[model samples]
Target: TVLYYDDEMLLELKSVVISNCAVGHGGRVIIPTEIKEGKLIIAVLQGEVTVLNTLGERAAKNNMVA
Candidate 1:
């Protein structure tokens, strides 16, 4: 499954895969969903984004958009 917006993207995957790239210009944040199963991994394939912490505060900023 896949979900996308101007500022967020998420995928529900249980295996490896590759997809085409369609860039969305005009800077926006990207929040990839957290997967509690299978020792969660994250990769920054392109662009920039802002991440928030558990306390609703700024965590990290930039480059985690895929």
Candidate 2:
């Protein structure tokens, strides 16, 4: 599910693997370091997102909103 602006879906990501998806405002995500086996797992229900693995560092760090 995806919404641009208040469209709906709000934002949902559960055990979802991603190679793309760069939204803003919340549920952040960034892992474009030339894509070294890049991977951005998601499990948020509210806000916060800043995971960067694949040897890039920043294993996981989100506000965590169940």
Candidate 3:
């Protein structure tokens, strides 16, 4: 799952594996890394997020400014 700090929401990315990234929010950003062909689930509780993948990097937010 890819997260954007400015968007203030969690994204359930699909058909991709996530690795070597950091999750800053209170909840979890579930990526399809294990299955390799499954749906990604992003559960946000609080704070912002910055998701980094092989293609590029992005950020997400929840009330607080990044």
Candidate 2: lDDT of 51? 38
Candidate 3 runs further than 4 Å off: 1-14, 30-66
Q: Which ten residues in a row have the lowest lDDT in candidate 3?
A: 1-10
Position 53, candidate 2: lDDT:
37
- lDDT by residue (8-48, candidate 1, tens digit) is 22232122222443335754223333422333334433434
The local distance difference test score of each candidate is 0.32, 0.35, 0.37
Clashing pairs in 2: none
Candidates ranked, most accurate by lDDT first? 3, 2, 1
Q: Cα deviation in Å at residue 5, candidate 1? A: 20
* Candidate 2 lDDT by residue in tens digits, 1-66: 211222232243223334555656775654444431332432332334443332312333333533
TM-score of each: 0.18, 0.18, 0.21
What's the number of clashes in each of the models? 1, 0, 6
| Candidate 2 segments whose C-alpha is farther than 4 A from its true place | 1-14, 25-66
- Cα displacement (Å) at residue 60, model 2: 27
- Candidate 3 Cα deviation (angstroms), residue 47: 24
The C-alpha local distance difference test score for the whole of candidate 3 amounts to: 0.37
User: How many residue pairs of model 1 clash at the backbone?
Assistant: 1
The TM-score leader among the candidates is: 3
